[model samples]
Target: MQTPSAADLLLAWERGLDQSPTRRALSLLEACLPGVTLDRLAALPIGMRDTQLLRLRESLFGNSVAAVSECPDCGERLDVAFNTNDVRHMSVEKIDAETMEPQTQAHQLHTGGYDITYRIPTSSDLLVISTADDIEPQLALLQRCLTEVQQNGIPVQANALPDSVIAAISKDMANADPQAQIELGLVCPECSYAWNALFDIAAFLWNEIHAWAKRMLHEVHTLARTYGWREADILAMSARRRQIYLELAQT
Candidate 1:
């Protein structure tokens, strides 16, 4: 997929405002990756989906992803910066040629006297699970993703699995797909405490896109009022050109 132009990103940002984060992520990818169908993109594993977002994010913004979090112990806020490469788990070999999307391998585990076969959860699974009013979303997700299960050489019901077995499966899934959830080690200078901060790529990228789209809308309004330019014309201009025109309009 080619890099999204300024116009393309602006349109995506506008379209995503009314969408839930899951839907917004799909919209962003659809805008950037026209080659891949929406269904195929939705079927991609969460980690693979995130790998694509990280690529698009790097292209549109930059490699450095900056974030801030409050220290749970001391209540002090900490600034964190990391590169896209840090959390990316999909290697070049797993990328499919036709879709240009990362493909994840199926995993099997023998634990707690049960043989479990599963694949990494996909965006489709996430969308369904998130909409469910479950007390524990992870358990619900595991239930949906459990492709096959056998205990003591006999078929077993996935829902009837015990909490201990579920925990084991969850741990194994996390190890097998590291990129599905990213946790950063954070230190609080004031309290001398350290904690692992969970990072949500979908939320972070959507926040950034929302801010950018608002700023671009303001610029478009200014240019449109001053020079009678269409929104399309304003968005079509390169970022450099738009800034130059904004400066001229201000004068």
Candidate 2:
């Protein structure tokens, strides 16, 4: 995927303003990968989809990612800095030419007198669970993921599985797809407390894009007022040229 032009960025930013987080992320991906259907992209395993987003993020922004979160124990804010290489636990092999689908290893686990075969949860799976309220979301996720489940050499219902069995499946699923949920080790200097902060790349990237769009709009406003240039003209200028104009406008 190539870096988005100023027009593409602004168009995406405007379109994503009223969209849900999932929709916003999908829009960004759509911008980078033209001709790829959203349904096909959504069908990819969450980790696989995130790997693409991370790559796109690195291409558009940079490799370094800085984040801040409050310490649950003491409410102290902690700053964490890392690179894209740190959280990337999975790699995409070649895409299938005929199907255009990414190849991934299916994971299996044997526990609690049962054998389970499953694949990592896809964005479509998460979208389904996001609307579920009848059962626990985790259990719903597990049920959706179970491709095959056998107890005592006989097939058993996934919904009827015991809590212990479900817990085991959860642990194994997490191990198999580490990129699904990224947790950061954070320490608070003020209170000597530590906690794991959930790092969501989609949300983090959206926030950065939103902030950038707002700042760009402000710059356009200032420049337009001073020189009567159109928004498109201002955005079309290179970042260096825009900075120079902004500085000159400040005088």
Candidate 3:
């Protein structure tokens, strides 16, 4: 994906304002990775999509990701910080080192007299499950990813399989697509409560963009009012230059 310019991100944020979280992330990818169709991006395995979003976060902010959560036992605030590489754990080819592209591959699971072939989930799979009111979302996702199912060397339906086999599929999927989910282990200093926190790079990156766009817009307002500069001209200035000009405007 191409690195997004400030103006490009601003446009993406605006377009994503009214969208759901899934669609919001798609908006960012669409703006940054031109020539890639939105449908193709949506079809990307969730981990690959997240890898791209993580790259975007590193580019716009930095490698360090700082976050806060409350302890469940004591309600104490826990501050967590880590580097981007922490969550980037997957096979080198599965997640390309140079291009950061994800390779989607089908995997096999043989257990409880069942043999199953499945692929990692994509954003499109999530969208389909989200809109299906008649089925359990998790079950729907599992069935959607199941490319083939067999029992006793005979073809079988995924839903007919035992829950144990279903769980095996889930576990294998997690292993195959490590970047799709990230959990941070945290221990509260007060109560010593320990728990795992889920980290979503797409949400995290969007929030950073949201805060930055607000600050930049405020700076633009200040400069526009002070010197009658156009929005385009204001956005064209380097961030450091904008900060200097804002300081001058205030003075």
Candidate 4:
């Protein structure tokens, strides 16, 4: 069986983004895997996606990626080198199937002085959230996604819930699951300035793709110049043979 290539996974994600253009662009740049359904992609663990993207970038580009940042306090600029292999080796906790169900009842009960339940956001929940037009609707959708059941005797309705009730539910759900939150922290070594860094997966993946394309293009150019070969022919050469040709050309 042929293992799925990075390109194949990328294409699948692209095809899955029919409802939202923002999501489509995000998926392409993030290099998110194609789920069985569009909703499943949203609930996917962010760390898992980050790990996969890093591995894919390394396969296409090189191991080392330069990360540049500006210090928030002193306006000092710094460049940090990150190894894709190190990222690949980092441990990520996966959400189990037992906690995958939506928490509709819990949120409804929380409004009536009952305890609420919450679960990690899944790819599907993200899809629903992304489609929401306003903050209230978004909160409602989130509540519906996270609320598993209510400790109170009140019955939960998956549909026909009011906006205010949904907001309350979302708040209760968020309070229940601290682990669902994603954080990016950065500390400045010089000034001791601390800031929450924005780690955008889409932007990172796009940078990797652009870098890989440029490097491959450069290799193709070198091969064509040295051997008088067509671009297509050069690209078709095995990576090992290409390296050997490049070495021979230099000598």
lDDT of 1 by residue, 100-215 (tens): 56656668999888999987888888788888995478877877888889988888877788989999998988877777788998899889899899998888988998898889
Question: Where does model 4 exceed 4 Å of error?
Answer: 1-43, 58-65, 82-114, 136-141, 149-152, 155-185, 221-232, 243-251
What is the lDDT of every predicted structure here?
0.84, 0.83, 0.85, 0.53
Off by over 4 Å in 3: 92-102
lDDT of 4 by residue, 1-251 (tens): 12234344435354634535436433552333333233444445444444444545556556876777788799877665666553343333443333322322222345545444555444455556666776555654556564554435564554545666666765654444422332345678789788865544445656555565566678878888888999767766677888899989889
C-alpha TM-score for every candidate: 0.93, 0.90, 0.92, 0.56
Per-residue accuracy of model 2 over 185-210 as CA lDDT, tens digit each: 87888898877888888888889888
Q: Against the true structure, what is every candidate's RMSD? A: 1.8, 2.3, 2.0, 6.7
The candidate that wins on TM-score is 1
Query: For candidate 4, which ten residues in a row score worst on lDDT?
Result: 98-107
Pairs of residues at least 3 apart in sequence or in different chains that clash in candidate 3: none
Q: How far is candidate 3 from the true structure (C-alpha RMSD, Å)?
A: 2.0
**In candidate 3, what are the lDDT values of residues 1-251, reduced to their tens digit?**
67787788899999888988898888888877877778888988888888888878887888998899889888898889999998887643365444434576778888888888988898889888988999888789988999888887799887787888878888888888878898888899898888988898889888989999998889989999999999989998888998999999999
